[model samples]
Target: MTTQTSTQAQVIPKFGEQKKAFSIDKLKRLVNAAKSMSDFDQAKRYLCSYFIPCSNPHGVFMWRSEIKNLEHILDKNISKLICSITKVFYT
Candidate 1:
């Protein structure tokens, strides 16, 4: 008796566009949108260059936790922003 094995190739999806860095204009638009919303204060604090102190020690810890969560969300968008900028300029 003889046995034969068959193998198949796998296909992957391509982005078709090149990656690029985020632009100042895009960042400005995001900042503007954030400012216009009710969460502006919290967003501003998260984006601020200087650290803001919380009234209570526990408040400070909570702020840090919230910031960390925000960072996780923002990080994903940041990648998309960069890709968009790259496509705009290069393509």
Candidate 2:
């Protein structure tokens, strides 16, 4: 009896060819939409500034726990804001 083994080749994706797991523009739009919510100016500003492309003197600093609190005021869907910010900043 003879046994044969088959080998498969692995393919690596190039930088440009790699598919993005998330979209920055989409996240920015979502943040902007969240900013439009009424009665949460401070939270809005904090969240918006987090997305600023230019140098931020104020700095981008937010506690993970704080995100939980802000999510209540900003969005009904908890994961929307959290996931976007986490993916953009943490990753």
lDDT of 2 by residue, 2-75 (tens): 11111012232322232333244644544444323442343344444333222333322322333322111222
TM-score result, candidate 1: 0.20
Indicate which candidate wins on TM-score: 1
TM-score of 2: 0.19
CA deviation > 4 Å runs, candidate 1:
1-18, 35-91
Q: How many backbone clashes does candidate 1 have?
A: 0
Model 1 Cα RMSD, 1 decimal: 18.8
Global lDDT of each model?
A: 0.29, 0.33
Off by over 4 Å in 2: 1-37, 52-91
